[model samples]
Target chain A: DVKVTQSSRYLVKRTGEKVFLECVQDMDHENMFWYRQDPGLGLRLIYFSYDVKMKEKGDIPEGYSVSREKKERFSLILESASTNQTSMYLCASSGRGLLDTEAFFGQGTRLTVV
Target chain B: TQLLEQSPQFLSIQEGENLTVYCNSSSVFSSLQWYRQEPGEGPVLLVTVVTGGEVKKLKRLTFQFGDARKDSSLHITAAQPGDTGLYLCAGHSSGTYKYIFGTGTRLKVLA
Candidate 1:
């Protein structure tokens, strides 16, 4: 079975603090993504990495960034955490091809910025 | 504008009741997927519909993709308590790796 492990389930941080949410997948997939889910906004993509050291900005990438140093790990970085950034962060991984491939998600990390 | 939108943002039904949730979009998609998410957990893929007008079944759940590939629906024959969760629809555009998720429908089933 494919497993995507998130480093943290809940986090509380002060304003202007830099936050790091880590994710690791054992499926050896090439496509990894970071998404923030809000109550009525649903899941909005923050960033996506198609290969190691490659990243692309998604819809709501204003205050977030991501790092993909290795094939199995992807990290979401909050440069300067703000109260508005408080939301559930999700990490997902999928195969290289888009067709017939389903993205698997890890247990989400709920961040609360005060 | 929201690329994908789901109707009936919240639904509560008795056990053994049948229900259907709709996900609609104006833009065409290469593929659409349905997911169920429990509280404090990430969403899990329930079904993926690729071809237009295609239907797939998983136990009591049935998923259908619209003929234009811009809409989809999920119908539960007889919902159980275990079926309570947030249902989300995600669409992937052609030549892109990113998926645009729908607003989501929160379903609650009571026994």
Candidate 2:
């Protein structure tokens, strides 16, 4: 079975603090994504990486940035956390295919900005 | 713009009942996917409908993609307590690698 691991399951940070969310996939997938899931909004993509060291901004990438140092790992960075940035963050990985392939997801990290 | 919209934000029903969730869109998609998410866990892939007017079944669950490829539906023949979760529909954005997910439907099946 393919596995996507998230660094933290729960986190609490003060306002204006920097935060890091890490995701690692063992499937050697070529695509990795970061999304924030809210109650009514579902999952909104924050960022996605198609290759190592290459990243692209998604719809809601204003307060977040991403880094993909290796093919197996992708990281989401919050430059400055705010109260409104608190949400359940999800990490997913997929192969280099069109829309037909399914994306494997990691257990989400619920972040709370105090 | 919300590319996809799911109807009935919340549903609570007794076990053995039947239900249907709809996912509609104005834009055409190469494929549409359905996922079920449990509390404290990531969303799990339930089914994917690619061809227009396609119908697929997984046991008691039935999925159909509209002929125009702009809509989809999921039907549960008999709901169980284990079926309680958030159901989401996602589609690959046209000419892009991004996926647009629908606002989820939260379902609760009571025993």
List ranges where model 2 is wrong by over 4 Å.
A98-100, B93-95
TM-score of chain B of each: 0.97, 0.96
Go through the candidates in order and give each one's DockQ.
0.70, 0.65
TM-score of chain A taken by itself, candidate 2? 0.97
Q: Tell me the fnat of candidate 1.
A: 0.67
Assess each prediction's global lDDT (C-alpha) against the native. Answer: 0.93, 0.91
lDDT of 2 by residue, B1-111 (tens): 548999888999999999999999998888888999999899989988889999999998999999999999999988999999999998874446677788889999999
Scored against the native two-chain complex, candidate 1 gets a DockQ of: 0.70
Tell me which residue pairs clash in candidate 1.
none
Runs of candidate 1 exceeding 4 Å displacement: A98-100
- Per-prediction backbone clash count: 0, 0
Q: What is the lDDT of candidate 2?
A: 0.91
